[model samples]
Target: MKIGDLSLPEILKKTTATQGLCFDVGAFSIRLRSTHKNFIHTFHKLYRDFPVITDDQLIDFHIDMVIANNYRRWIKPQIIARIDGQQPFQAFAATHAMPLFEWALNWSIARLGQHYLMLHAAVLERHGKALILPALPGSGKSTLSAALAQRGWRFLSDEFCLVQPIHGQIVPIPRPTPLKNESIAVIRNFDARVFIGPLFEKTRKGTLGHLRAPTASVDCLKQTAAPAWIVFPQYQNQAEVLLEPLSKSAAFLKLASNSFNYTLLGATSFNLVKTIITNCDCYNLSYSNLDDVIAQLDVLSDNAQ
Candidate 1:
């Protein structure tokens, strides 16, 4: 069953503050327990396509978002996120519960999912091949990925590029892409069909909103794609679209720096990164226009095929 199959009351009933609501997101299963009404409503809408897992299934992470039991609960109203019975972050305003959930999930994946070579990147698939956009924040990674996913590519993840070590394949972990500040408007204007959540103002990352993962991408959660291209994307205002070829050696160093657990994995991570760099076409892409970049990527994919 899917989250959408249940009504608000039904979801509330199944996801009691005690047992939590279990759902499958790609390879990971999460049990989320929250009593925040707005958070539940928004989560239900954004994660409607994800598979609802039974409590009998093995859960990878147990997350709870509850109202603070202090004087602040009534004064300012704060929400605390607890993962595996441990509070990893300070309390956030009750209004920022959704962002807290998203960030907490990211933290859990990065810290616990050491099986894969996790990179700070946005991954998308086309014709069974993955295109990785690995860049630092404000480099237009999420925006570009979100745009590409809307165009034709299947979205894997906007935050993590999980590469299996042995097979050298990219794992799909499709989730809502968080759009910060101006990106919220950029995506909204870029695609009329895109569904963006409510604007969350004055957070640490500035005003934030999330783009719902495409239904097509969410449906293919189990599908994995081999790495074919790595493009380091940067959004520059009024800049002409440019895609410059990058050396494999340079790609290796950059990708290594972008990894979450590169040092921890050691030699295994080294070999996997080498394999990816050797096999994939590497490029440095800079653009101001989304349509132009999308067109260029389409041409690149077609020519490669």
Candidate 2:
């Protein structure tokens, strides 16, 4: 059953401040135990489309967010995120529970989910082919990916591009895309139908909010896509939209640098990266207009098909 199938009261009972809640996100199952009511409430809404698994199902990650035990719990409270009973990060203010949860889950996947070659990129699918957007921070990758999903492209992931090592297939791990600062406002203005959660002010990445993943993408979590195009996106103010063709050799090095476990996987990663670059078209995209960029991408997808 889906998380939305349960009422708020029922969710509280199952995810009691003590017992925790378990849900599936693409290939991984997570058991998150949090006492922060706001975080739980927001999670329930943002992840309403995801399946809720029974306690008997195998859980890949066990997470806990508990208020500090000292006097701080009452005076300017703080929260700690623990995975497998070990704290992997410094404590964050209790008010930032949602961001903390999102960050912790990302950490868990990047550090422990070594079965796949993980690239720090956003991925989406259309016509059975995947589009990989890999870029550094402030590159508008998340913004572009979220916009594409709204325009009917299936969202695979916003934070990670998980690729099956054996066959170079892109796996879907759709989660809430965190839109930081101005991007949140930009997305809200871009689409009237989009659902964004409440804003969390003064976080490390500046004031940020999460854009909910489309239900259609979450529903098709089992479907995987082969890489079709690799586009490195950058957003510049008032810049003309430009999509330049990139050489395969340059694409390989750039993609390899964007990966989380490229060095760890050694030759396996090398061969897989080569295979992906050789089969897919690559481009460098710079734009200030979201609509124009998306339209150009749509034309490319249509032409390919």
Candidate 3:
């Protein structure tokens, strides 16, 4: 479907003063009406407001969500996400929708042909260079990015990092971070200013909601951040902070594995990764304390100068 050409569905809610808020989900402008009476209903209304993104020449895949009875998600296709219960959809959708939107929109716009690759990595900008966190799921990449965004570093994305191959650089596409379970509370405790939405319950990934990314972060999309550092962060149960350097080859493999379209991008991806890993530094950072990690990152950033 032509997302730009698509229009939003009309919303029906008693308490809503307005029909909804128009959101640009890639090419699709999703309009959501907040009922206030039911937050989940508001999200659902927002979702279906736009025309269904069909499987076509431009769209590689199709995705939709089904919320049945407000208590259970009875049926949902592989493409359709069923985010039931009192959890945040941001976290649940980030792993799937975030990258998919990037692919679909990029393809529609034909911005980088089929060569652009996306990854589920958190990117932050300090000075002019970008710090790519190509870490595993359990890592506190989201938390660290959120804290940095709240402070000074421009938030490119909380869950996915878009890499430009020809230029051998990272681009910013700021969006909200989905904080699950304890992580939500952890972020809330650290800063009450966090904009957390309501949660859906009993989903496969547990309850969910999202912490909004900074608006200032999204405004710096034109500026390309040099790949100054690549750190694989790990969040252990109760471990002291450690920032050990990893072998360049190992880091390369790990980064390639985390990438969305590395295999498809072929030589372009290889050259980009080679250039990034060769000149930039790589490290393995593990921490249970955010303040400690933040402080250490400050020192590391300063040393880079």
TM-score of each: 0.99, 0.98, 0.69
Off by over 4 Å in 2: 17-19
Best model number under lDDT? 1
lDDT of 1 by residue, 1-305 (tens): 99988999888876665777999999689999877888999999999999998888899999998898989886899999999999999999999999999999999998899999999999999987899999999999999999999999999999999998879989899999999999999999998899998899999899999899999999999999999999999999999999999999999999999999999999999999999999999999999999999999999999988
Candidate 1: residue 138 Cα off by (Å) = 0.8
List the candidates ranked by lDDT, beginning with the highest: 1, 2, 3
Candidate 1: clashing residue pairs, number: 0
Residue 168 shift from truth in candidate 2, angstroms: 1.4
Candidate 2 global Cα RMSD: 1.1
Q: Of 1 and 3, which scores higher on TM-score? A: 1
Number of backbone-clashing residue pairs for each candidate, in the order shown? 0, 0, 13
Q: TM-score for model 1?
A: 0.99
lDDT of 2 by residue, 1-305 (tens): 99988887777777764556888999699998876777788988999999988877899999988887878887889999999999989889988888998999999998888999999999998888899999999999999999999998999999899999877898899999999999999999999899999999999899989999999999999899999999999999999899999999999999999999999999999999999999999999999999999999998898999
